[model samples]
Target: MSADSTHAVEKDDAVFHLPGHPLPALVTLDSTDGSGVDLFMLSLRRPVLLNLFSMPVRDGRVDLPSVAQHECAQQLRSVNAELDALKQQMPELAVLGLSLHAPECLRRVREDLQLRFELLSDQQRAWTDKLELPLQSQDDGSQALRRCTMLLVEGQVSRLDFPLRQPSEVGRRAIELLRRETGTM
Candidate 1:
């Protein structure tokens, strides 16, 4: 991370620092549309709400049968709905979903949930590893990223919500942050 990417704020003798690590410039993933997405480049163009999802893996792929019953999937559905509303209000924001699932599986989920944002696949775990995201051990003894949300501005993680407790609150929190940053709130 570059010095310029580091962010901090001071108010009334209190200091708040953002996440220290900026996403690597070379990070890329396969979008559900079958095109390569340069995540760092996208962050440069607009603020990105990057939502990370972890799903059960089976037979070298995300277990499709288990998704419907998975809590993460339920959380994803709520988050996606909230993000859709956020996009309607702020079209400039770039909302993306990232997971270890294959592109085809992500596409199916997108369609099923009527998600408005793009879904990207990190099948090789390269991007997650680079970010050093926390991993959750699955019942099948596989590892998947823990559910989290990141706000990336100009390739730097400005805000992060790890171990997200309320899936429905994510968009509201993001809106509050963006509005405060833009002086619209």
Candidate 2:
């Protein structure tokens, strides 16, 4: 569906609501370049693979450790690299990663992983609160958004995977969904 006047632009202050039922002009933070990315605007140009992770991955798991202290930012980087390669096959596909971390930390992780795609930061939980994604209680008495991924075809939510069972399979899973949706493979 083309982004036109039919789709209402939902907004509350700086928070934009992207309901699972499907909404238009989705908005979220894109701290990857120290600027915000309008997901809807971007998707209007092409399909989007939005991966929402709880926190930065370190040593194969999501850990709250300094980038220098962590030996590796596994899981995500591996999946991202795979997905980046698949971009050649799915020309119109845009892969994006969103995490609930500060931009500073995200930058370090991005540099450490040498990611080709953007890794956005949602430090204020603006998107999370609006999405109302499932949350898990942390040992520190705080709640964290569960890791999940969503496929947005032309700015509309198409498919979602909650509490991603296997982080390693993110690329493959997204590829299969995109191929199935776009009939690319």
Candidate 3:
């Protein structure tokens, strides 16, 4: 958001432990199963891929007069389509959706998107600040989590994709990484 996102990211002077990472501890989300999942606490004995994202709106910058026509059902469908696409592509890899919205928004996202993967609440953005992850702020002070990916192997962060800056791109590259790691390449 500041000229180039690359410049916004903070670089650590030294490596942080897998568990010590702030985001890891705050990395809680829900899965399609309707159960809570703690990504950091998960036993990643094998390679693990996690993709993070900022939620998108359908009207999507429509700053014009109200559209000629719209329906609640249509809105819900639109969101579900996107969510389904993400869920399908992000499987096997720990897919995470981080939002910079009010907790109220999460409920709406869950109901409207029919979301499958659990979502992380960056409402206060306490976790983002702790990790120094680059994020842009909404007027309300919520942060648009600048997208990134982390790869963990044998319970330690090995290579952080760290640059997969979009949800779809992140998913595509993460699946590719998982395939390579499994020798399915």
| Maximum-TM-score candidate | 1
lDDT (tens digit, per residue) of candidate 1 on 63-179: 778877776677677667577566765678888888887888899888776777788998898888877766778777777766666777887777665556665566565565556
List of clashing residue pairs for candidate 3: 30-118
* Better lDDT candidate (1, 2): 1
Off by over 4 Å in 1: 1-18, 58-60, 183-185
In model 2, which regions exceed 4 Å deviation?
Answer: 1-20, 23-28, 56-72
Candidate 1: pairs in clash: none
Model 3 vs. true fold: TM = 0.52
1 versus 3: better lDDT goes to? 1
| lDDT tens digits by residue: candidate 2, 1-185 | 32321122222222123323453345658667777777767777887777776553444445655543432244466557677565866777788787777777778677777777778776777766666656666555556556556666665666555435666776676666566556665
TM-score of each candidate structure, all chains considered together: 0.80, 0.73, 0.52
> So what's the TM-score on candidate 1?
0.80
Each candidate's lDDT (Cα)? 0.70, 0.61, 0.45
